[model samples]
Target: MWFRNLLVYRLTQDISFDAERLEAALAGKPARPCASQELTTYGFVAPFGKGEDAPLVHASQDFLLIAARKEERLLPSSVVKDALKEKVEEIETAQMRKVYKKEREQLKDEIIQAFLPRAFIRRSQTFAAIAPKLGLILVNSASTRRAEDLLSTLREALGSLPVRPLSVKVAPSATLTDWVKAQQAAPDFTVLDECELRDTHEDGGVVRCKRQDLTSDEIQLHLSTGKQVTQLALAWQDKLSFVLDDKLVIKRLRFEDLLTEQAEQDGGDDALAQQDASFTLMMLTFSEFLPALFEALGGEEIPQGI
Candidate 1:
């Protein structure tokens, strides 16, 4: 499946596991429903949602697709507070004494335990593509915290995951600002119409533009006033489009018709086959795109000693 957002990381070491080994490792902490007293539970799940018997790791063309599922009991704080208040009032009235802080704390815990089983379960999944050859792992998460949770779980399952957030020698904000100011981008990258500009000064103002000419005088005016581009929309080689932010996170990723059409032609009628085809195409495309992107940003910042 196509990832909507990319939180890219660079692997520091090579992974040598095959499908079976990786599957067994993931199964060690397979996803399970939250217990009656548990607020949240997280573990690896079948990437294709093909049922419990399906492998948790879906390997294709030396690329591994994995998913981490998190289930949390939805117990709203307001509901808990109202219930606790009622219990506290009831105890005070029936016992003919004011409830103490220690007793109230105990009652709150009891209330939460009683509500846990009846609470609705909110479930979400984070998907990641691990490219061993390219030494990269791209997570489908917009939030860095959520992406780190998935990575932590993966590390626990596999015993180790040597990786760090992808960084480049040049700051992304600087490069983005330069692109908009010059009204030009690196080869194979075209600047789009949407961007977020912010003043370089602390506590300064921010301006967001959508569906407007980024090269126009209006945008130029903002830049002229000491604003820098924090985020910019870009199209890559006519095959992919996305918004790149100062932190190097890619958001609102879309595979263009050029790539999707190729996937459709190669993908067979089978659902699994289609998914596999799409995954392969996406990984291959990123393999090429990321290098060009890094080169455009001055080059990848290799960690010391590696």
Candidate 2:
């Protein structure tokens, strides 16, 4: 099985200057007694936004570190490819700034033109010392699942499933009912339940839910739409119960009386997009880290709007 942990983090305190140092560490090998290795430096090529003439102001100092290894390669191509793709997206957005000022913000023409057929984008950066290197990486003091551990756990769990999954959309929403909704439609289906793993105190957090109690109005919303699902149970304070549906979880849920032994299962891929406008890496580790960090920074969580 192939996997690596992506330690996405958000910095706690603001880093003011364009960073040339950390990149070295991420991309370079360790320093020798007589000579120093080159520092790895990642760059924020450009920024773009809808209806903006010039690129929206963006911090150039921020950085991202992707820790990944393939089911095959020494360095996970997933990380390298993901990084390269991001750079290209940034470049395209930067190149398309002018068209955005016009009435149509999509810049359809730019999208068509940005990728030159013969003139492919060749991206390679070289700088001496200080960037995220392939060896000895440091995370922003916040990481729970590395790519390897997470993917392995997922693979084994999937193997044990009684049946295989077919794809569609909308498996679940709201983290509370993840278990009950993962099983449905032998060949194809979607359920409505979400996973809210934001680390914080809420009146009705999953902590309050009885895993055996998958009979909420939210869970039944599926039956209303001609779908069937087996609700997985959750312990009040358990690790993320994604796939694998840990039998231990069932055991505990049984003890807590949360499982209904006679239900079916159904669920699938989640909708994920880069979380925020800024690229502060540390807080990105936790779903709630950003919101909490902002408050600590004296900024309230403002709802996005015009």
Candidate 3:
């Protein structure tokens, strides 16, 4: 359960549900398959897709993952529209009269219904975890819409989930630009070899650099042209390396050397043991990283039960 991208949010209110309570709530509305007429369906499911009927909410000691599963039919709009048009034309030709707009729309709906049953079904799962101790919800998806969809599913299951985008008092662009200018990293962070610089104004341009020295003259030229650092590659205390964006989403996260060490220690066998060790390692690391990140971004403490 490694996460490549992070869509993070701050839980405005405390969630104090024990494992049993959360499981019961999720069971009340489990994931169901998409019906013939339904285009899409969403609900909770197993985090790792383990077991026949995996628990709706996978709860560990410090973390709980609420897995959201969505099944959608692959019915192309143009295909349906073309088929409807052809059918409408056949009917109009038979009667020797042009079909009205309302009738054409009705035919379109009918065609969709007729084809819905034969449409291919696509399934997707997105996982989001709640660290109540940290008062944060971390989504594994990079897409904001997907993350919001998962949050909406959680809201339906739990009745309510008060959350907001994590905000920091300091301007990320300013801090990042300063770091690049000084050719140094922020406190507790080490600047890496990738970054994205963009203009702060509307319709501004962007420059992306990978595996290039950020302190080079070319990057300095962009900075001189009022292009602020919107994203930066950073290594946090040598444990985690990722691209931290202006939006505060961490992408391309790499747990340096941990996986290698784990594999070597386990002799690269026993998949289950490896999974457990990796999960434990990630949980331990993030428990420290999250709060430290929040502090580095000039975030204030969120009072309990707010």
Question: What are the lDDT figures for the candidates, one per model?
Answer: 0.92, 0.26, 0.81
C-alpha lDDT of candidate 1 relative to the true structure = 0.92
Of the two candidates 2 and 3, the one with more favorable lDDT, higher being better, is 3
Q: What is the per-residue lDDT of model 2 for residues 19-38, given as tens digits with 9 covering 90 to 100?
A: 33422332232212211221
Please provide, for model 1 over 126-182, each residue's C-alpha lDDT reduced to its tens digit, 9 standing for 90 to 100. Answer: 999988888899999889999999999989988998889999999999999999999
lDDT of 2 at 266: 11
C-alpha TM-score for every candidate? 0.96, 0.20, 0.89
For TM-score, candidate 1 versus 2, the one ahead is: 1
RMSD of each: 1.4, 23.0, 2.6
Off by over 4 Å in 1: none
> Which wins on lDDT, candidate 1 or candidate 3?
1
Candidate 2 Cα outliers beyond 4 Å, as residue runs: 1-17, 30-306
Query: How far in Å is the alpha carbon of 42 misplaced in model 1?
Result: 0.8
Answer with 2 or 3, whichever has the higher TM-score.
Answer: 3
Best by TM-score: 1
